[model samples]
Target: MDWYPNSDEQLLLRTSARFATGMAPAVSGARWFRDLERGDVQGELTGWPPGPTYQLRSAGDKAARRTGRALLVGIPLVANLIANLGGASGTPLGDVPGRGKPDEPENEVHDFPVMWAAPGSLARTVPWQLDPGRRPEDCVTDLVLTDRRLLFLATRKGSLAKADILGEFARDAVAEVRRMKFSEVNADVRVTFTDGSWVRLSVGNPDNAERLGQVLGGAVRMLAESELSEGQFDRVARFRADLPKTAHPPTYSRLRSGVTLVESRIPVKAGSGLFETHSILMDDSGQPAEPAPGDL
Candidate 1:
């Protein structure tokens, strides 16, 4: 088996990734997409004949499902909000994907597609394994970026599951990655491919979503423990010591303004793919600090 992030490959970011759906904003949720000319969006790919919520045969069923789950998942969503308070994730309940755009009446629909492509565009070739509806819940997927490539990796849920590369593209195949501020948790990102085809996806959390885009675009620097200054190393040690023993090994990155961002993921509820974050900002002397100009 080809081990991902081979020995020489440097990992930039690895985060939970999935299609940007419209359902969270409204009951008539649909998968979002657009054509190459950027002429119009195909955000509701799940719709029959592929149109809008009004076109759905059972938009009310979608509404009912939303209302039913509202009470059940509401608390978790709120906790999700508080946990990500300072981070990028979490938009209010009613905010739809294209709330502010009025000119493109199509854009006002309840959905927002992350794709930009032409008919038969390269984006149509994205692997189906990345779609949740097409896969088993027992299976999990992640979008991973390394110094050399951008790819998806899949595995069974839980720690023992062996991960296999689902698909990949040369790093050059990607033209740009935009961190979109709209949507739930602000976790959405638009990745435009070199062929002019693009996709919008939601990484599990907003902060990680922003970091993924920044690292891929070369806006910041990811660091290895050995690269840390002696003082920074000592500081990280203190930070790591305070985290739970189960926390994943911490990741370090240096922002443009010379501040180091250190973060780690720890188990949240103890099931497959459940983890929360622990982060700290280190200043010049390696003391805890607040966001600096570049850190923002």
Candidate 2:
């Protein structure tokens, strides 16, 4: 059967996509705190300790990688949905106001690194080996790592064509710094590489909400370390260090908060199956060691 969206799935996926983008990548499962802080989603950090110096934690197994891939592709929202759907217990209803359903049963709850596998599918592919430590509940929601490229998948309003894959950015764990942005589908986005060459991207693929993410990801350009300062580098490095040890950690930060995070996900599609793959690198929860001056 073709991967057609049921009405409920459509609503859930679309609604999830909007809110999903707003859901912040968590540090040690404390993502709720970030969501609450933004007033996008609700809830509080019940046991979180108060401190100006918040500890950065590592991401859980695949969950971290999945979240990373999502952010890399500019689909953090979709990634969050995939991660939660693969684990959390909820109706997957569009009307629900939160990431987790208030009425979800504890018995049905799932952890991060939610793995959905389908063998030998050409429509989708993933590089799961890259992240062996991902969990079902971590930010890295979906993943696909291959020799040619790394792919992240999220539930979207439409589908993605292969051509959209070009001009997108892939996760670079070894990179000194990374940046992401979201805007209108056709908005002109510029990427200046450290080498001075720049790439520009415009969003395409209206069929699948996930497809738009492919456009965003394909537009990625890598920057040189010189672009970031000592403090920025330190912030990214510390976040990387805190990510779960699945593969090399992907470093990231919020321009709004200046708090760095990491996460990624992958998608695999065969003739008859479509699945989600994931991995995690870092979490911003557990106390991270303060970086020495100029060490970043």
Candidate 3:
């Protein structure tokens, strides 16, 4: 006979599945804020306080607007249906004529409950380094640290309330987290992932960078130390050292029970760098060896 879940058990299963998949639960009265910008906006335009204002909006409303836009744009409906679904001037539906702004000044920096997590899942917002030609101060967002992964929420351009999901780096996905000193006042945190992709975050102050280094580096070390055997760890370190000197350090991942994967970019004879990845098995001593065909 097969077992069936009761209503309560089914709900629990669903909630657990959502949490595991990174789906946020419905939040009531959750205020949304614009991503921090380097400089001030023009006069009284948004009614936000001067000097690093947290532009506020309703999270529920933003999600609703997103749903409506997807339906109107994605569904192939009749012209009349499309017009009915749209806002005045044939613009996207929802919100006032201007960008969606909250009715009251919700600028008080309330603790973002969504960004916070349980004991093992700690999250915080730190300034990140912008890409070339962008202002240094423009990058600030939440960095969520979980026992199994690291995640970040990035705000989209021109949209005050919307955020883009930046990363979901698992414990094994991260290769290294180190601090880089640009100058006496400028310091940055660099996160190298197992896939050879890396990101540099400008934490504004050097002290903040130090704190981030401690927190992030400590998490990585704890995970690696606990999961990898002594011999496997040594092989991972050696694999990192054997990579090309000019390229970024290769990322190491303990893929499964006994398989370890290394990802790197090496210069090819064709002049362009070739991305290379290797999967090896660890013996009883934890030394890396060529994996059997089925092991891969």
Best by the lDDT measure:
1
Question: Candidates 1 and 2: which is better by TM-score?
Answer: 1
Clashes of each: 13, 82, 3
Tens digit of lDDT per residue, candidate 3, span 1-296? 01122233210000000000001112222222222321222222232223222233368755775566555532212321322221112111222111122221222122211111112221222122122122123333444444455655444322345444444556566676566442212234556565443444443333334434554554212223335667867765666576556333333333234455443333233211121222234554565455444322
Report lDDT per candidate: 0.63, 0.26, 0.34
Writing each residue's lDDT as its tens digit, candidate 2 over 25-51 gives 332222111221122111122222232
Query: Candidate 1, residues 1-296: lDDT per residue as tens digits?
Result: 11346777766677778776544434134664556444454443333232332333266676686676566545434544444432222111122222122222343244455566776655666655666556677876778887788888876765554578877888888888877665455666778888777787877656666687788778888887778888888988887788777665777788887877777666555455545666777776787656655564
Which candidate, 1 or 2, has the higher lDDT? 1
TM-score (all chains, Cα) for each model: 0.73, 0.22, 0.26
Compare candidates 2 and 3 on lDDT and give the better one: 3
Task: Predict model 3's lDDT versus the native.
Answer: 0.34
Model 3: lowest-lDDT 10 consecutive positions = 12-21
Question: By TM-score, who's the top model here?
Answer: 1
Worst 10 residues of 2 by lDDT: 11-20
Segments of candidate 2 deviating more than 4 angstroms: 1-226, 251-296
